[model samples]
Target: MPKLTKYQRRITWSTGIGFILERMDAMFMSLALASIIITLHISKAQGGLLPAITAIGSIFGGIGFGALADRYGRVKTLCWTIIIYAIGTAGMGLTNSFWMLCLFRIIIGVGNSGEYGIAITMLSEAFSKKYLGRLSAAAGVCGQVGSIVASLLSAFILPRFGWHVLFFIGIIPVVLAWFIRFHLPESKEFTENRDAIEKDPNRDFSHWTELFATPAECFLTIRIMIMFMIHIAGYNGLISWLPSIAQERMNISVAGSSLWMIATIIGMSLGIMCFGIVQDHLGSRLAYGIWLLAAAASVFLLIIAQNKLEFLIGGGIVGFCSDGMYSGYGTIVSKLYPTEIRATANNTIMSIAKSVGSFSTVLIGFLMDHFSLMAVILFLSGIYLVSFVIMLSIKELKHENKAPVTTTENAEKVAQ
Candidate 1:
């Protein structure tokens, strides 16, 4: 009900821009893969490996830039990340050789990899605990917007202008870096920490050590890491398989398949919005449990749907239940750590989780080999169940001075 402060306003806008740009370029690779395989004269295997390479680049980028953001500065490092993302994206368009394409994709991966942890760290620090989840959802919703626009544009652009031109369009976010560099203020927490550092010139500020210096912090850190791993694994497994499942089961063409994706993304938007508001009201544990349980139930809905119309409707609900909980993590993760290493904590967990989650491809493949596709998908739902159980042990980290809290103290405070 209250107006967002100046800091919250800037972070939401800037991070939203970064997500839009970063995700659009990432989505472009998906749309361009077909044309790229043909133009580069590559094997089917190579086409599949392209995105994997980009992901690998992201792991390194996240660690490298995450630390830099802590050591150097958030705003300055963010501009650098944008520049790298833009250059990598544009270079992908200009390249003629297959290796060059791989190179540029890695570059793009490296650049975009740093976006989430750093930007979300900025957002988490800028706002109060009350608005953190909603703001986090808003940032992700911006990414969804970018993905939708990219989907639409790629449909229009690739057929008319070719895949290379699509990559050129990805570079448009480079302009955003200019605005961020000039207009965005450093996070207040980081700014004050910097001043403190200046006043005491010899103090050590190594985040990796501080993260484990205390048992409670270490326990919380590990718990969140495991939770992310399971959450992402289940999400990636189901969503990645949905296209093929829809195309085969519905017997639809590529364009028709887009309907399923669009439906799911719409669901994702609604789910994100719902989860944020609910979590802020209900506290993280209860909110996550309900959403994850709903996600599992929604997955079974996929099995019962007999037609495209039913499938589309189910897809929306599934998207909502499955990913809505994601809105909580930005607030939750940052809350567990201090400003001294907040970016470090977020990026570290994100990088590791994404890398581990990629194994969902292998998991699905392994499962389908042993069982039916429907059965495998249904089994994947149990992942959320497992995550929910783990979450029970992950208590909320409440601090004084109005820092974000991850758990509740009493039943009456459920909606506090």
Candidate 2:
């Protein structure tokens, strides 16, 4: 197997733990839904509010944590997010009311959402320019492993010990956070930036808004933001609704539905693994464009799929195309910005995209109630086509030996 350097391995494992724990919490929610409803005597609508509200909260968490990771340090801010995530998740186990679960999930959303940008930024900074794409993809692929683990863990824990114990398990990632703080070396770029900031505390490091200070910067930021929005909306809609879609389409029991999730998970993991290398071989826009197009085509197959075998195959292809492009986002955002606000750029945009895009769940639900599941899936396919068109508009920053997008002025130097 291809291996990372020692530094990359440490980063991979640390970030990977966050990914696993986060996905486990998410997957556990589906299994625990019945228990939660019965315990709290809440309506299905009220129960659904919890996840939606949590996603909204994560948008703020991402921006706030991204800024902190920029001004303070990536690892330190990341540790705080872990604490937040653990608290949010574990507290849910103790909730006696629906509102309390909503509150804790909001907290969890912030932490989980914030975790992605900071971890990706750190990995991008730690690796050399040459290794950036694959390592980041590896991190994303690790996240899908988290999903797969969640499915397995949910299958094991939910029936035996019940739901609360599963949430208490959320506390486990705190150990990983501790390891990151004590053992992992801070990124060299972050260390340099911290020193520079201390010497000149007056220097403004917040570049989330300043990203549009120039034409090239504005163009790049807007293009990627639009592209990521479509990606998140389409991907989240599919994953959230897929089990039901599969259960209905395939006429399977809840236990049997794991096959659908597993197939999708495998496809997603493979897609990211493939996209990571493809991004390096092809340039930024083309790599994304290809996958976005494939994603649309895959969804078309999913809607038309007639039998269990066809749907399973279509699910795998959709998962591969839809989620795999996530790795490319890290690659695109990493090269498009400099170290000073790199973390902020990655987190804020992604968080915003996710927050907005997550509404696809509600949208799909509405459409399904009125139209049909096939109609909703067809809508998703059209969204992917839109994403592909948006990808074409992006003017990529050339991956050069020079520090990529270090400053507004420097951004122009690498502009293609």
Candidate 3:
């Protein structure tokens, strides 16, 4: 991999920090949920709706702002997204009513949704293809770090300052908005593409239609969407219930569960780092195949564990294999689509898949109610297996060196 230019480093940090803020806000909301429910006198169902509202906001924000990024400029749109989410988060602190808080959550979700797709698009334009994977993964690792920080911050602040303070802390990232606006440059590839489009009177680019303009593009998008669905399903299904499972089945204490989370999260971080290296050097297919298979196998470790130590180790392996490949999806779509619709492709596909995948928690609960814990684990393992097969069947493309958006011929060139 080549050394990064100063601007590349800035983009990387901004992207990474953006992810960190996203994760931190998510964690704070999760940790403060119990307090928010009691203070607002809302039922469990209404409290649950808060996150759901956020998810709905994310779906809309991902598509809407993504199109805006393609039309406007990446850095300019990114700054707006940051400000939107920051203001929404801080608004959550001031709201006294349940409906008001719900509205703010929607705003927060919408703002958070654009960061990943836009940042990934920007990075794709800024960095060398050779270094893209690791850099993306590094940013993801930063997100995991953000979760850890939020957890620690919640532990300290929730006791002293109350849940509202958590939302207030989110406003701190607004300062990052200023730094990004002034320091970061627009992607040269996107700028050039915009110029070319402007110069040609006959040219038409619709972010949504560009994704499915041809049969090949449609199929490619569908296949990628399925892969994303599987990825999110496997993650949400398993991790959502892992702690409860460990507590119920293994008789682990709350402290033990926390340790298990730390272990698993560390494993996830290390796995993401390794994925970056492996995918960058060895190619995405081999890296994904290996991780998916490992994920499928590792879940069984949870089924067989006899002690807390074994369960913790199993959780770590599961985290490593199942969640580590998260960043690679951005790298994949970035290569397949042209710059004009790249953010849309990334956000639209992911938000739709994520919206679908969010049901996995419910599905897992249904499965657990009807069947054994082992059965639920088996189901998750099967999701990984299906993902592996889908991954293998997709035609691989050679890495493009210069073009922001790949031409069909370049996009279709099979990897040797």
Candidate 4:
């Protein structure tokens, strides 16, 4: 591979860090769930609602920030999102009531989802199609690094100082916001479009309607949303419960759960890198087909394991298969949409899917209370097959030029 230019390198690192922070928030919430339940004296079902609430906030943030990014600028929107995430995360440390916790989680959700969409959209615009898959996957690998860090902190802090300190640690990502503000420039593609719209009064750039302007477009958007919903459901169903399952089933300590988490994160990083390479060489269809099936089979390992060694290795395989395909969502959305609505398309579909998926945490928690761990694992595994089938039907977008093809051409290509 050729070396990246200074700007490419900057965008890569900045977006990678953005993903890191996002993943860190998720991992912290998962790892800290047990402690939060005890501290707040909440039931498992209610505890599950916290992340769901955050997902609800993301729905608003994703749509709102996406429109703002298309209207204003990706970098400017991204900086504010990060600051919002930092503030929301910090506020969690001070809250003792469940409602207050819910409020803060919403803030974190909004910022987290916004940051995710803008960062991916910016990175997609910054690079060519040649490097899109791999660079996006690289940022995903960075997200795993964040998960690893959160796991370590969970092991060290949750047992020592408590979960409040964990929320305080979230405030640290604000430093990343500072660096992004000073160093990054706006995406050239976005800037060009903005200038064109400014120059031509006749050009109508209002984009939200274009998403559903026609039957075909609306159907395609729904198809993408369902696939992503399945993706999010499968992921959250397995990961959100893993730590708790290890503790309950295997009698693992908080620190030991961290070890399991680290092992899983290592697998996730390797899998994401490998998926990017595979998707680049092979088409997205074949690549997703393989990983989705692997995810279906691997999730069973979590339920059947009898020992720590089995669980540890099984967790890694599960992580590899399950989350390896996560970053591809961004790449796919960015490819399918034009510059004007790319951010909106990316955030709207993903956040809505996440909203649906996030609630699965609540459902899974309720299921675990009533059903067996095996039941939940079966649900997670079955959804992957559903996603795999969906992947086969949906066409991959392939654009050869920096300027994407016209909507007519895009539709024709998609049909082919």
Candidate 5:
């Protein structure tokens, strides 16, 4: 591989840092939720509603930010999101009332909504298509590192300093925004479309409408969206219950659960990197299908494992297969849309999928309360099968740049 140019290097650094910060903000809440509920004297039902509120805010925020990025610029939108999330995170520490905490979570969600979409689109546009999968996977890996960092901090800090301190630590990401402003350049694709943007400065970019206007586009978008929903639902649903499951099933401590989660995250990071390389070689469609099936089987294995070592191994494999395909989704979305509408299209589909997954957390938790772990795992595996079928239905969008005549000639030659 050739050495990265100054611009490409800057893109990688900014994206990796930005994604890490955003992911820390995203996963911190889940890791600290039990602590937060105990500290605030809230019930599990109320605690569950907080994430739902955040998801609701994210749905609207994603569409709004997507339009804003298309109209104004990606960097400006990202800067504002970082600032907003920082304030919300700090405020989450200060709020004593349940409703007030939920409100703050909504504020955080608004910032979190567009963070992934803009970063993925900007980085994808910055790098060459040949390197897009690797770079996208690298970002996913960075996000997992952030999750690991948050988990480590929660393990060390939450017991002594309390959950409030965790929110206070979120100030780091807010400060990182200034660095992003100085270091990250506007995407080349966005820059090239400046003239068109200038001509319609006030136009409303309804990404949902644009994406669903045609049958083929709608089919592809829905397939990706369903896959994302299943991935998030399965991964987050299991992880959210992991500590409780460990305590109930194996008589483990909170700290021990955190250690298990760390192991799972390590597997996630490795899987992200490996998936990128595999998708590039194997094609996204096939890579996604195989991984989804593996994830389903892993989830089932996780529920039945009686020994701690087997349980942890199953958890790691579940993490690897479930979260591994995330990078491919970004790469596929980038390839699916043209430059003009890429950010909006990517954000709209992904945000709704994320929202669905987030909302399902409560439902999953409720089911777990009533049913066995094995039953929940089986239900989640069924959802993964839905995603797998959807993924296989979509036509592969990679390698679209090759000449159509060349493909036709090759087909004719093969026939001879």
Candidate 6:
């Protein structure tokens, strides 16, 4: 591997920090949902909408900001996304009504969506292809770390200071944005693409139709998007409902559930790191398929675990396999597209998947209300089986010989 320049190092560090902050803010609400519901005197069903709202915002934010990133530049778009999420998070503290809080969360979602794609793109662009998998995995691990921190804060801080304080504390990420804006340079990939466009007098900037111009490109896009949808649906939908599942099915306390979740997050962090290493060595598609299959098996085993210890062990395994593959999605997408439409492609495909997954959350909640927790887990696991098939059937891009690397292609590669 070639030595990374100082600029590349800074971009990676900044992008990882930005990704962590984005994930932390996004998850803080999930950890604190009970507190928010209690403080506002809202029903449990209404409380569920918080994530749905964020998902909805993410659907829009991912596509809109992703396209904007491709057009305006990744660094500039990232700056705006960070600022938006920071203000929205802090604003969560000020809102008293449930509806108002939802509005703030939606705004936060918009920022959260954009932040993810741009940061992933930025980091991927800065690092070499050999390091892309591990770097992207590291970025995801940082996000999981942020979630773990939020979990710890929820466990310790919320009981004494109230949930509002969490949002107020989220303001710290916004402060980090200044450092990002001044310190992080435009990705080398982005600069090259910009220069190419400048040099070409006939280049059209008015529209972006090349993203779906080819059948193979369109097929790959659809397959990946479907994979994301099923992955998120099973992962997010199941995890989001795990607390309630633990409380009702396992007869565990909220604190116990939180600890169990902490264990899962730790497992997820390890899984992501392991997946990255495997992707770098074995390849993304194979690594992803193996993880998904393991995850599916884990979920099925989890459903049959009779005791708390057994359940926790199963959950951890599921976390390791299921959530671990998320980092690979960004890396794969970055490799699949060119720099000019990289963010747009990443955001659009992910957003569509997220939208489907978000809607599935509602369905999962309905299923849980009618069926047992085990039943829901089984259902989600079945969905992962479909994802496994999709993944297995798709063409593995990494195996192709001397793939054409355009300016846009390089930009997408850098951002991965």
**Against the unseen true structure, what C-alpha lDDT does each candidate score?**
0.72, 0.75, 0.77, 0.83, 0.76, 0.76
What digit string (tens of lDDT, one per residue) describes model 4 on residues 318-405?
A: 9899999988888777877788788888888888888888898998999899998888888888888888887777754433223542
Model 3 gets an lDDT of 0.77
Model 2 worst lDDT run, 10 consecutive residues:
395-404
State the lDDT at 67 in candidate 5: 77
lDDT tens digits by residue: candidate 3, 1-416: 66778888788888888878866775666556656767888754565456556766778888888888888888888888887787798899997889888789888878888877888888888987778889889998998888677767766677678888877886776676557656577878988988987897766454665667678777778888898888877875655566557757888643345445667777888899999899888888888989999988988998888888888888888889988998898988887677778888888888777667756656666676678888888888898899888888777544433354543433545332
Q: How do the residues 62-129 of candidate 1 rate in per-residue lDDT, one tens digit apiece?
A: 87788788878888888887878878888887888888887887887788877778888888777776
Off by over 4 Å in 3: 30-52, 94-102, 158-162, 181-183, 243-259, 365-372, 397-416
Q: Would you give me the overall lDDT of model 5?
A: 0.76
Clashes of each: 2, 0, 1, 0, 0, 10
Q: What TM-score against the true fold does each predicted structure earn?
A: 0.86, 0.90, 0.86, 0.95, 0.91, 0.91
Error of 3 at 144 (Å): 1.4
Candidate 1 structure lDDT: 0.72
RMSD of 3: 3.9
Higher-lDDT candidate of 1 and 5 = 5
Model 2 residue-pair collision total: 0
Query: Runs in model 4 with CA error above 4 Å?
Result: 396-416
lDDT at 25 for candidate 2?
Answer: 66
TM-score of 1: 0.86
